[model samples]
Target: MVAPTIQPSLPRVSPWALSSFWFGSAFHWLLLLLILMPADIERLVGSAHKGTYLGLLSGLGAVVALVLPPLVGSYSDRVGKRITFIRWGVAANVAGLLVMGFGLRAGFNVYLLGFLLVQFGNNFATAPYSALIPEYVAPAQRGRYSGVMGLLQLSGQLLGGVVGALVGTAVVPRELAFVLVAVVLGLSALVTILRVPEPPRQELPADTAPRLGWLQLFAQNAFFWVFVTRALFSLGQYSVQPFLQYYLHDVIGRFRLFGLNLGNAVTASSVMLLAIIVGGVASTLLAGQLSDRLGRKPVIFFAGSVMAAAAILLLFGPPFGGVLLLALVFGLGFGAFTSVDWALGSDAMPSRRSFGRDMGIWHVAFVAPQLAQTPQGRLLDWGNALQPNLGYTLVFGIAAAFFLLGVVLVQRVKNLK
Candidate 1:
């Protein structure tokens, strides 16, 4: 056989080279703290009732998630500089964090104020920041970039969990966690300010692209269904997440030979999260590669199956005794699904003219679940009335259903070559 000379790999932007990663990493760590805060705040307030507070917090976030992206993206495109919006957005997010931190320190009616500021700032920054990914990355390299992004996100979440565990173990005070969150976010903002190169202003063709009203654009896209399906997937996935630790502590602990320990609960949740991070990074990379090679629908089908399987396992049992190996099963499937989901979502964006606006609409699906938490909580309460495990099982089942629905909808997406 004749030998074929191999070409050297092309040099592109290093996935970790940009300031955005630093900013994004810190943003993720602080976000995880926010995730852990409801329970912490409930304990701080000397009230056993954390459900209503959490429900309201998540619901308001969902509302903001739905509204912010299109507004930010459209404006950014019109203003002709994405970074200008991103810079201001990060500043706003920092301001929001300061308010939240001060509220925590001052013993004000901080829950509502904290939640609202955090949600607004977080979404304002996130919507524009995410839109940049497609703008900067070449279509061919997107999967690798997405994988790197997912890996960083997961690592940041794990880092946050470690901090939470230390706090729970008396290694750090709970109040200090909020300070840590603020500092991390401030650092993330600084990184964005320093690192990401702002792209030049967009020049639209005189006649090819008209400045359409938001509602007009929303009404025109067939991909809108895909966006809604994505939102459903988000709703199902997150609806069960906030309560996972509670489940491990309350339900799984019953099967323990040793008594339930809070530290053990955090450890188990940390383990599950670690599994998710690992699986998610691997699967995301694989999905992106496969989507590029085998096409998007096949990868979507494979990923949907993995997601549904994970949901079923979590529904049936979680952190099952070391013997059953439940965590591994859930982690593998969940991770693969996430990888494909990012790949598919990125694949579905339209032309550059509508990219910012459409992407903002798509992201609404990602954040829409915050609103659903209120209804989910009500459903959970109703389920508790019937049986202890019924609510969680139902939630997991719905998550699986949404995953499947997302698969079905992806089949309808066109121009995804």
Candidate 2:
């Protein structure tokens, strides 16, 4: 009888590395709260120009996102010192937040400058930070690890929302919120710097340099399809997000929560955040494991379907309870998507040598959607002009379409099961 063949097991990851992943993910999600700050801007600018101002702000953010991450990622790859970049990026972010706090007290242009600084700094850190995942985790374990990261991200988002809601209630000053986020970001960075071990430096032969140019990679690589799917899906989600508060306020009307009368925007936002936190915990914990067994495509497809359904439900203008139910569904979908998508992207990466660069390019998928905010805002204004809340209706419909398109396009990726 022939001896049985033994399969090689993946190397075990350190506890410190896992902890770093958790903290890094938390920082990423916490930063997402910046997107929700247009309401604060509205206080300064007024309602009529809110869309225009937001368009300009998001556009500036997009410019930073477009330029910084890949540049920093490429530089870090060359230097073989990703953590150094991360530390510098965190310091820049803290400085930017401080400037923003002062700027908000001074004028809009100053606030814009500070916000742009924050964007550049955050993206600079994120590129190298995200590239660390594949270096640390084994292919067999990427799914499980991605799940944990997703859970931490959701937890961070929940925390940020709670903080924002408290600020809305005057329980904390608005500037204090910026301080809090900065502190959290700084702490997370410190933890990552101390805990996560860097990957061994690779010394490649001069003749073996990456053959494909960056732009060529976009056309010749299958990973670009992954980028496309993520970008389109994000565009769909963002098309409505900047306008959600306005919709809740203007269209849904105000209602009381916890015996304290609150604006419809705040009440709805709080409820939705709660629903996301509750629903996301389980989905995020489970989806990655399921994707490991069932394949990434199925989990992603299911998530897209669920998200599309939630978007369609929103189009009906449901009651508050119904809205909560829809939010739960959306959270479930988003949780699963967030958990598995990173693993999927890692699986499709073109070359390990260019992980940072490729991932930075992938980061563009995220920023590209920011550009959509302008068009979406314009669409909202035009639709509302045509009919009351027509803009919101159009937004949801467009969101659903993009979700479905993402689901379909993901099927085109042949590299991963």
Candidate 3:
């Protein structure tokens, strides 16, 4: 019998590049929680149609996130440079933040426009940046690097929670917080420009087209299934995230923490976020390393199970202690999922030559959940109308269902072992 050909491994990337990439990831997560979540909540707080408005903004963002990434990523592939897109995207994000800050101060409609711009800028940066992983890291080492990225992302989330807590306690102006987030994003861009040199471009075929249509590219692709799994998992994970502050404040009611007078919803939500960060950081590090050895499927299955259980616990478990435990559990699952899922997707790439385009296509998984967020939000509102805090219960149940569905669907992936 003929033996299967063995592929040679790519060279390992430098520490500087890895660190810069991690920093960039960290900054991205930090800004997402620190600026976007709080700003959105602020916009919708007193509105009579809070759920509808939040859903509309989220849907608009989903649209931007869906459309821009693949197009920009394909463009980057054609040009053979991801860094330029990253730079411009970061700049655009900063401009969006400024617009958001001013718009928030002025009116809700203005802020909605700014929010859309932010989504465009963020998706543009992320799609190309994600493609860099395959470009820079060897396949064998993708998990380890993904773990490091996840750890940094959790750390950023932890810090963002702390900042949010401070803001909740009136220690920082929300406008100043937005400015700080923009500055951090700018600094991260600088680091990327300085330390993370773009990989040499793959020479395309002589007759290669500049862009492949999405439908053509997606047909018969196993990565599309990976994309579906990710969308379901993210939908479950994010179901509560956007509205968590309100849930804690409005449903759970104010309660003392650590004998200090921190009873506000934002503070409570931040505390829970901190718990999640701690749990996630540890699991992410371990899961990433383990996936490198055991393959991505097992880690993802385990993580998804844990996440589903956590969501269930949050719905029926005890109040304070249960909440804390559930947060930790959720974090553990989220961290593991975050670490392995990227590696899993990377393993399923259709072509290396079109990494940017393909990765952009993969990113639609993450953005597609935003489309559901509106309906989910309306669901929550509907539940609340029937009974107090019932909306949150419905949301958690739906989230659990999504997580379990993801767990089941991930088993269908036949490409990765």
Candidate 4:
């Protein structure tokens, strides 16, 4: 039998509480190590089949991401708050890191297992963690929260890159890196658990509301479509991302500027990443703040426009000797998109009824993009063989179209009001 329904006013979230959200995101860069380990694995194995091995590992990780979230999110929803999963998930995450450390120390073929576990830990905690935003945050303050999170993400990426570079670039002492990452992740998890209090669960009309079929529940919510749009856009956006180093090294630096020389290629790639970080910081912060003042739609629209422009620049800019400027522009656009996109996603959820479950759906959008990489790689190889920069140009042009389509889709989502 259904119980009586009660709905309380949403709670006010403190800035300190919001800061913890960013703190958690900062720890996320550790997950990148999982993706990166394959290169080291290739060197260790002394095989020419690194691509196949990398694909298998990544594929397994993607499968884990797809499967784990719904189970974890549904469990969190049933419990009426996310803390249960959040606390334990962190413990499990640390344990996974320890396992990874031991695996590396033992010289076991454990990269695939460790990567899958990392994905599981990340998603298990991630969905439940994000659900807190819609429950506690005032819709009006989401912009500030989004901005801070963006800064945290960028800082985390920079820190991760610096750490990777500093680890001597040789074997990387895998066990040590794993241990340090575990410690850092644990510290961040502790901050979130102790500092941020969960919002009380809402009580909706239980008696009259019919049990919902998944499709029916989804059909009533326009937010799901927005999530779809977000996913498709992300897939299109990243179609060009993996090739950034390639573009800088082979096309811009080696072929065009340095006459296909290998020496200048590495330095150019490094400079491009630096440019990206700088531009990304500037645009993300600016977009987040602007969204706070002007409303999300306007900021989202502007971000889309910037992204489209950047995509076009990437396509043609290499030939004109403007690749660095294009790289910076692309970074700016991506920063703007990511900075506000999270809060925008939170705002569009159907309700706090199952914030974790909803957020799991949102995350699927973020993760699904990786599955497209294989096809994109094939396209790149084909295009590169035909003409220099041709593959990149086509890839980025498609990304631009996706951004433009996202702008149109954003207009259709009147759910925020």
Number of clashing residue pairs, candidate 2:
0
Spell out the clash pairs found in candidate 1.
23-188, 284-339
lDDT of 4 at 293: 83
* CA-only RMSD, every prediction: 7.0, 5.3, 4.5, 4.3
What's model 1's TM-score? 0.84
Q: What TM-score does each of the candidates earn?
A: 0.84, 0.91, 0.90, 0.81
Off by over 4 Å in 4: 1-12, 19-27, 30-35, 41-56, 97-109, 169-175, 201-212, 253-271, 315-322, 382-394
Instruction: Give each model's whole-structure lDDT.
Output: 0.60, 0.74, 0.74, 0.64
Off by over 4 Å in 3: 1-12, 15-48, 168-170, 202-213
lDDT digits (tens) for residues 338-414 of candidate 3: 88776777787766667788898888888878887788778888888889879889998899899989888888887
What digit string (tens of lDDT, one per residue) describes model 2 on residues 26-132? 54444333333676578679987777677778877888898878788777666666777788888887888888765676778888888888887888888887777
TM-score attained by model 3? 0.90
| Model 1 C-alpha lDDT per residue in residues 187-260, reported as the tens digit of each score | 75666555665565534444433445667655544456567666766776777766666656555763342455
- Clash pairs for candidate 3: none
Judged by whole-model lDDT over C-alpha atoms, candidate 1 comes out at 0.60
- Give the clashing pairs for model 2: none
**Count of steric clashes across candidates, in order:** 2, 0, 0, 1
Query: What does candidate 4's lDDT look like per residue over 1-417, in tens digits?
Result: 443221336546555555553554454442343223543555555334433344445556667677777667767777666766777777777777677656754553675566667777877887888777766677787787787777767666555544543342455555666676777677767777876766555566644334344576467556766686687667766566545545555555542444443244333554555455567788877888788787778776776787788778766545423766766776686678777877888787765566677777777777767666556655665676688767676777777887888888877776663
